[model samples]
Target chain A: MLVNQFLILGAVLFCIGVYGVLARKNAVMVLMSIELILNSVNINLLAFDLMNGGLEGSVFALYIIGIAAAEVGVGLAMVLLIYRNKKSIALDELSEMKG
Target chain B: MLASDIVVAQNVAFGIIAAVMVLFALRVVSSSNVVHAALSLVMVMAGAAALYILLAAEFVAVTQVLVYIGAVMVLFLFGVMLTRAKLGRDADLNNKNWAAGIPVALLLLGVMVYVLIDGLGDDKLDVTSGTAASTAAISDLIFSPYILPFWALSFVLLAAVIGAIVLARKD
Candidate 1:
């Protein structure tokens, strides 16, 4: 019962992340959305691990968290550095990378 | 059936939290204030942790709370506060924010929903997950088979910490 609950929650989080990634104009906000996406995946892993007769999901979640931490660190640093140089945190302004 | 009833109830609960998570995610993106976005992201993370708890993976749930709530969020907020990114800029809203990403997300969402609906009905495995067992098992795994990945991840974090410091320095 609870596992199902968690699965739905994870799915919901992923959708929200999708919205954030798609809708947000600020790069930092996009990063936050990415965090949401990652968290949803973590929730699923933990939930499924419990249901799968093993701790594989939880273990994977741990490593994912480590990766997420590093990602946030590097991402926020990049945003801050970019903000410093360009005085704008808008995704629209950071088109230099895409082009 | 009692099991069916329980499933229904839990599904309702998950639905509610999912709503909040998505709502906050929307706020995080649509709001002009970077701090507001960061705050919404907190809601998102906490909601995710709540789902973890529901899954009976108490250790992972607690770790989620500790890592994202305790550490990641603080780091994000500090960066936001320090940088003083634009709080409000209505000069334009037209950007490539959702241009190429919306359809992909929807496609993924459909896939996820399909998988969850199909995969989670029958319980072939028992969840013996709790603080003690999980902690012990996780530690054992890390010390034995997963040790390399653990250390590699730690080193990556260390590198990130160092890089962030260097990037933020007054140079």
Candidate 2:
């Protein structure tokens, strides 16, 4: 397949992720959107690596995966904490500090 | 099989997998149920892993499956369950301005696709090229000049663990 095909796929995924982040009211759903964006980025990285005949992109992608795991861990913990305090995980409902 | 035949097969596979991924990604965002979204995200991740394999990044593809599908999705499921979100369709799942999202997403997608094609349209993915980064080389890269970042990533994970425990703990 042409490198352009992968690029287009990644772009489409990223756009969908952006829509999710913008549209979702549930905090967990937003986090899932972020994960989708990260995955799209990984696709682009691997595609570029293949095109450039280098392994650096794959290594970078590995690091990105680790970072994403950490992000979800921390993010979910925060969501749970919010749920505990407010009994809800809706993003709009937690706007107490919107002064 | 002949080389051209293999390329044709890869193109077909890529088309099917990319379509599946896009569909599941839409489900992940549009679904009213958080659990359903998470489950569909798993399919999206799996499709990405398949794409990685097509890119000839075998080790990276394995890591993608192990880390994303196995660990990350499980973490999301745990979060969804522990949070006790309502399992059915949610009426208030989307924000009031959700309609505004469509044009913005389309604009971004259009810009990116244009840039990518204009910038790298001539370049082709060398599927029959050299092998992907070996585990040894990856480790060496991690341990050499990138060692500091590696340690920093560990610290980040450590911090996340501690922060999670502390934040989620009942007062």
Candidate 3:
């Protein structure tokens, strides 16, 4: 069991998530990127837990999944509200807060 | 198969799944259609769950499947459909300065790999592992020492539900 392999895999996923967050203009896509980032962190936690021979990491990962669900719920609701108001979900066009 | 063969097979499985995961993750970000992106995200989530199983965290993997792929993806599709996203490609799906992010993303990846490798090089898991804490032990931990945070998480979920309803409801 090569632990470094798993770590590198998680790192790659995290970087891709970061790229998605930065590059995507769709609010939903940004939320998706956040999920990817969260999943990568879960992977890291599980890997470390396996290395340390304990269940602490798995428990933490479970909580993270719960929080992610709540977060996406709220996030999607906000996106819906934005769409209702502005008729678009594009982040670039949501710059009304720009000064 | 022999025990050694099982390890080799696990490595191969990990390699294939990781490759597929990276590909779908890229598609999730770069795909022209929002629906396609959401579906691709499902694939990524499933792959993540598979990786968790590989890590010997079967219960976590099952929760991931149920919560992420089953529920979260459905919620995303609902949001996408309700938002009336254009079916075909959307021209404004990326920012004008998206190109600049490529370098930043690469830099972040490089830095992460460097630090992670230096910090935890070749650390092998203890093969003489004791019996993994069963679901019962995990539940006890969650209920005993971690109960406060657990309750707090429930409150957060409730708050999110109410907030979603409030925000999404028509006036």
The best candidate by TM-score is: 2
Model 1 residue A76 lDDT?
Answer: 89
* Candidate 2 residue pairs in clash (backbone atoms < 3 Å): none
Judging by DockQ, tell me the better candidate of 1 and 2: 2
DockQ of each model vs. true complex: 0.56, 0.80, 0.76
Clashes of 3: 0
- TM-scores, chain A, per candidate: 0.91, 0.96, 0.96
* Position A85, candidate 2: lDDT: 83
| Most lDDT-accurate candidate | 2
Q: What is the lDDT of residue B161 in candidate 1?
A: 92
- B8-111 per-residue lDDT for model 2 (tens digits): 77788999999999999999999988889999999999999999988888889999999999999999999998889888877888999999999999999989
Q: Model 3 over residues B85-167: C-alpha lDDT tens digits?
A: 88888877888899887898899999999998898886765323435547887888788988998999999999999999999
**Model 1 error, position B126 (Å):** 6.0
**TM, every model:** 0.83, 0.95, 0.94
Place model 2 in a CAPRI quality band. medium
Tell how far residue A31 is off in model 2, in angstroms. Answer: 0.5
RMSD per prediction, one decimal?
A: 3.2, 2.0, 2.3
Ranking by DockQ: 2, 3, 1
**Residue-wise C-alpha lDDT for candidate 1, range B20-132, written one tens digit per residue:** 88788767657666676778788877877776665666777788889898999998887767667655554333255465666776778788878877877554323332333
> Clashing pairs in model 1?
none
